[model samples]
Target: MLTSIWQAVRRAVRPFAAAVVTALLGVVLLSGWLDAVDWPASGGWVRAHLPALAFFAVAFAFAVQGIGRVVRADRPARSRPVGLSWWVVVLAAAIVVVAVTGATEWLLAEADHATDRGAARVDAIKTGLGVGAGTAGIFALLLAVRRQIHQEHTAADTVLDATEKRVTELYTKAADQLGSGNAAVRLAGLYALARLADNHADQAETVLNVICAYLRMPHGRLSPEVSDRHESELQEAQVRLTAQRILGDRLQRFSQNPTWGGQVDLTGAHVAGIDLDFAGLSYARLDGATLIRASLQYADLSSASLVEADLSHAKLTRADLEDADLTDANLAHADLQGADLTDAKLTRADFTGARLPDGMEFRNGLVVRT
Candidate 1:
């Protein structure tokens, strides 16, 4: 009998508890039938456990609502106790109601003292089904919601990845096209390079020469070497004293535009080093300025003024000093190899230990009065 009842229950539970449809209709139909026939009261246990049955039945419905979520949980292997949710209470109350209605019906049929218990028993069965089936429906809805969210997130990630890849390809194509063009393209490339040199101190400095080359000028622009309101030097001390301390820091100031007039005018300024390496100092001014141990190598100082300036130990290798003035200036131990001094005034300028004007002897590693 136990085995037979178990098989019946298995069949009943197999249909996703949807069999509750018939069970519900039968309960309502039978209750009305019993009322029409004027049956007396069934028993007392049914009325006593009514409130408890309702409480537990509602709890059971809520518990089943969590089933879908629990099933979809990432770690589903762990054991879940029954009473953790009120599902156990729901089941227990249902069982009690079912047993009470069964007993009362038997008494009504055999005792001849009360009416039939069919109505109340049907009601109990209907309540049990609602709690059970409703729980299952809620669980399924939760699972659906979870699945939808997962798919949405996955789609979003895929779109983001594709967008990044496409942007990279477009940028590569743009760079390649820029490389094959003429002077205008070259200027454009240089401008792009400067704009892209944001915050990269070493990299930006490295690209300065490339910018000058794109401009089709031999001398690099001095404006690219320094920025405005330089913060590294010129702090405290004397306005003119700590210039060297922050000179390198000034290399950050430069325009991103391609139209750069290569002219560095530092006329009458008391600077310590006249470093114009690869600078566009065309027709610039430095008259009467102090330039000790200055480095003007590879600079274009064409038609520039250096009249009466001190240029001791200054490296003038590969410099363009055409028509420049060195009148009454010092050129002691300075390197003038490969310099263009065409039509420049060098009258009364000291050439002691200088690299030019043959017959200058190097006596005991110093320029002596020979």
Candidate 2:
């Protein structure tokens, strides 16, 4: 009866033993791969305490399995939820294992040189437990900090996403207002866009481009003739003037605000009587544009391209026109008093009746410095 009982126990344990051997083989293969990849945990303290760590891993697994089985047996139908309490228990178990492993290692090392083995063992145990507790505390603190940083990052991303969505909605609504039939609505749209650009520096160039494109559209000059068409043209001109004012305010020199330093492309745009005084318009492209009676006094138009542009009677007094290309441009009756025209190209440019700076003159359809 004793021999039969022993054989029965061996048969029951055979499958479990085979499973453990297979799991060990898998671990060995995994360790080899980790070693090949130079995994940081494969060396240093981990390598030195490999046996202890492996024992902890196996014991922890068994403990978790047993706890799960007990919970399931008690609950029968309801599933057990692994919560903070479970993690707390796991952490405590890990700390205990580390403390035991450290004490054992210290005790073994002290045994070799110990005159009084028992006292040496007690001292080693105390020192190891203290060090293990300190290390575990530091590890827990680092985990807490990491979790906090992750939560903050997630919240920041959410706020950024919401802000971007709001900006897009505002942009779409403002753009739609620009297409409205009412002049007041269009004017409101221009102001909305300007405010948006002012708040968001990244949107400044795009806003300027939209306003410039609007100015470039075919618009009849304000007419004195009393009619429905004249009334419509008058409203349109007012809207256009408001757009120009917005640009002028943003591009003003010495203004205590973020200025749009990018090039203004008003090519072929007709903006009669537009006010842009003291505007910073360096490198602007106004080629073939109509600027009759426009106020541009003291403006910075350095290196601007005004080829074939009509600026008849436009105010350009004291403007910076250095390196400006005015080839074949019409400047009849335009003011150039005290304007800096250094290195300016005036080939075939018409300057009939225009006021030139002192010691400067237009002779034979060309500007000449006396």
Candidate 3:
């Protein structure tokens, strides 16, 4: 116990001891006492400004301590109390007061060519005391302001932390609901995620990714045969349609509603007869997916991959298909009028009876001059 107490005391005194040593070293250097070749002029200057130099050394030591504390990553400055203690503040003020008094008296004596022992000396002391007190008050006010600003920042950080935690909780809960067996529950989850994404712009891409992933999951098409399986498939199709609608709503650029401009991953997704007109689907992946008769008019499909995808009888008027890959894609009877197909890959693509862009025609499964 005694040894532990001694260790704690040593730790407490270490910083103070270091500061004192630094201050003494600074004073010795300023005094030019350790000069290898002492100059008389340098010595005279040091003697003339001894008091100010001593104060500067003490200030330098304090500054070094403050900087060391700030740079020490192990301990945050916020963890400790800010500003000097009452006694330290009083001592600093007193030192300034005494220095100012002595300087004032010396100045008056030199100017008047009189002795430094009279009413003039007393007046100088009064003037010095008033100036020093005012300076101290100003410093105290600045410290108070700094403390207030720090407190406000801390409060803001706390609120931000709480908000992030709440958002995370909501996100996790909504994601879990997406895996529910009930179609209604899944639909609710989709809307919840959409709302969350709308409110938090930073999480919009993540939420959209989740939606795309859900759509990418396998789901059977509605069957003609009337049975329990058909009903279940129909219900599942409704859920899928809802998910598609959500994506369409956010992807539409012309719509007044908020649009999500992130890249969509619908690779191998079988979303047939979907309506995604005026949607911003830049860099979307629709490889090997079934999108027959899909309405994609005025859509931004720039840099998108639709390799081997079926788009038979799809409406794609005025669509932006720049740098898109439609290799082996079925675009039979699909509208391509006014569409921008610059740098698009149409190798082996079936564009039979499709409305081609002006000055272009389908020949040998590729776009060529009419």
Candidate 4:
């Protein structure tokens, strides 16, 4: 196979090589013996005629080929064309070769006409294509680089678009699944939606509220220590607690539609952060309950039972604690600033840091007898 390929290449090369040698020999002879010919004069001639000769060569070739291509193209040309390929290089090179041949003959003739050219061979080599071709090449290179960069960036764009589409699909499917599914899937999906969704998306907050109400725990309260599957209700009773906060406690009591907390006795219930900020909880039995950090600021706790309750850090500022139970309650660090404590039982109650009506300060672990 190698021998056959070698034979085929040689046969093809023989005629082309013979033509090239003959052409070169002819040029050498025409210019006189190649070694004896003056190259310095030829170089000088080349430098002088380079610019004009190069321009004519490229302009003529482009005009002829570009027009012929447009006339013969099968497809109709659009207003803005796509781009061309490497074949442009081949065409331009061919044009340059032809022009160089013509210029060489012209140079020889001119040299013969002008007598004293002392050792100057009068060469008409037109090799330099000028800045026009260089600028075009640079532009083509920039376009090529831009195309490559665009191709690279396209993959990232596709991935991003696909990710966004997938997230949307997942959101839609989850919502659909939660609608007509079992309590477990529905609950799970609802919880998932709440976590993953944007703030207040697709009524997720409302859905959790609905589920909590359906279980009838006053709020969303599951049985204590149960794993959401055993028995019924929201796990930590936080559902009802959240509902009470979300749907106001006063509104629940006063609502035309009655709720569970309204009917049930909440006489000593430790409802902190329940927004009872300035509520009237008078005569309520709230003894020994953890009212720690409760916002009872400005609340009317007059005649209320607050015996031994952990009112530490409770906001009882300006609260009416007149005639209220105050026996041994940890009122340590409780803010009683502007509070009216005129006649309340204070047997062993820590009134530390609690302010009095007459600017009287609460001492270290002691309520001062006025």
Candidate 5:
């Protein structure tokens, strides 16, 4: 708003400036022409009337300003109002006006022999006070607009901070629910975290890591304290399945939306009969884990750790296993057609009934059958 005002002021002052320059040039030429007939009388009369000329010039400028304000009032306001401090423009205009008034008074007083110098001083003082008042009004207007802008910023920041704090509290509560002994509570916690990850994309990777850590907890038959009986084992299995489903859904390779691509750490975790077909698990950690009959067809396992893990009857057709570790792992009857096993470890790994691609064998690590 202030910027627009300065622009308007500039437009108004331009015509006044042109008028002053033209008038000064005309007077100088008129004086030279009048010198041939009578330089003293005619030229002196015009020069003595400078006070009236200055008054008319100032009146013309004010009339132009009034016309501009009326036109602006009829126009609609802009959506985003650009503003700046335009007090400098106002001060410059006030200085020009005061200088013209003082110059006119000085010239007229010098021309008249009986002109009261005391009254001229009083009029000059009055003009200065009026200019100062106008300048102050312009400064106050700009200051008010600047204050409104600062208040809006403060309010927006306050709301954003409050929302962030609320989200953090909800995440903490859901994470605590995962540790409950009740299976329903654990299931609720899994769904809660899943919803959180879906709604708040910034926290998706952290939520995924938490779910992976929970699945990696000791859930083997040897740890009777963790999975004592059939009921406890069934509940844990359901929770684990839910966690795995959440992970699998976000690993789609052809999805258009932004998906999670962080490292999965199910290292030495028991995840038998888990279906992860076509899931992206590149560079993942599953060393010494149990994955008997797991569906991993066409999954990306490049540079992944699966050492000593059981993968009997698992599907691996067209899977990429470049530089993966499978030392002492079981792979009896697993499909390996079109799968890349280049630079993989297979020391003491079983592949009794596994289907290997043409010209590839799994005798003592992968090698050309010829």
Candidate 6:
């Protein structure tokens, strides 16, 4: 009957809870199941001697553990216990068990075995041996639990290392694809890297840097001599728009959750018809870049460069352009109300149909009329 129950308990207690589960199962199974066996005398004696039964349960558990140690001699080493040696903890536990057991026996008149001289000495010796075996079993069980936990942690670390390696390989492959001269291949690479970044957020900044570099590359009509004369340029334009859309999507998400927080450098690169509304572009370099009809409402462009750039009909309402350069730039019909132009260079810059802020005038790009 106990065998069947022990097997059930062993199957039930898995994955974790080794020490506690074993101790509990041992106590319940070996206590002889109070319901199955009959107690001597009336129920009063058994009721009064409840603590004695508990001690017997605990001692039986330890004795079973001792047998297990003998059977498994090649068990793994134990980890160090926190702030206490294993033996020290075992000794303290043994002392407490012995005291509780002795008290229970004495209180329940079961100390009659120690009333005679010869039997008393034998009982003392037996008690001592039981405590010793229980302590040793407890020490072994603690060590076994620690070893199991350590093995699990090591296995988890191995799996994580393998996963990281695979991710790195995928990232390298996608980067190679992006560098291909074929426009279709480059577009595929962009989507692949974007997917990678989405799955692995830690790579978002690195992936973003690559996309930014591609946009920063000189590949516009201004450089038609080295530009691709084939249909690839038109396809590349679509690819650039896709890249801009991806980047702008991430940047505009700063209000809800900021994932990408890196500086963008599009100096001397054409960025027309891109939707960058509410994007975080502080300290960016857009000098000489054509931003015709670009939506930059409430965008952060503080300390940016726009020298000799064209911003005709661009949306700049409430945009942060503080300390930025606008020399020889065209801002014809661009909205600038609530825009910060403090310490910005506006020499030879056009602002026709653009709303100027208070204490500012567009003539000669001066804040005050001279």
Best by TM-score: 3
Per-prediction backbone clash count: 5, 0, 0, 11, 0, 0
Decoy 6 TM-score against native: 0.63
Q: What pairs collide in candidate 1? A: 225-251, 226-250, 226-253, 227-253, 233-246
Model 2, 1-370: lDDT tens digits are: 9999977986667456655655665575556542343323334668799999999999999999998788568455632222344445455555555455545564546554789888887787777677777777777786687677767877887998998898888888998999999989999999999988888888888888899999888766565465666556788878988998898889888788754657898999988777889888899999999999988999999999999999999999999999999998999999999999999999889999999999998888777879
Tell me model 4's lDDT, rounded to 2 decimals. Answer: 0.58
Q: Per-residue error at 136 for model 3, in Å?
A: 1.7
What's the C-alpha lDDT at position 309 in model 1?
Answer: 79
lDDT tens per residue, model 6, 156-241 = 87898998998899889889987888888888888888888877878887987888888878885533356546677777877888
Each model's lDDT comes to 0.55, 0.81, 0.82, 0.58, 0.75, 0.74
lDDT of 3 at 10: 61
In the order shown, what is each candidate's alpha-carbon RMSD? 21.4, 15.6, 8.6, 22.7, 14.4, 14.3
Candidate 1 whole-model C-alpha lDDT, 0 to 1? 0.55
In candidate 5, the residue pairs with backbone N, CA or C atoms under 3 Å apart (3 or more residues apart, or in different chains) clash, namely: none
Sort order, lDDT high to low: 3, 2, 5, 6, 4, 1
Candidate 2, clashing residue pairs?
Answer: none
Listed in order, each prediction's TM-score against the native is 0.31, 0.68, 0.71, 0.33, 0.62, 0.63
| Alpha carbon deviation, residue 6, candidate 5 (Å) | 40
Query: Candidate 2 regions off by >4 Å?
Result: 1-127, 224-230
lDDT of 1 by residue, 150-181 (tens): 67877887996897676545445434534643
Q: Which residue ranges in model 4 land beyond 4 Å of their true spot?
A: 1-237, 243-270, 355-358
Query: Candidate 3's residue-wise lDDT over 25-46, tens digit each?
Result: 5576567554433334454688
Model 6 Cα shift for residue 188 (angstroms): 1.6
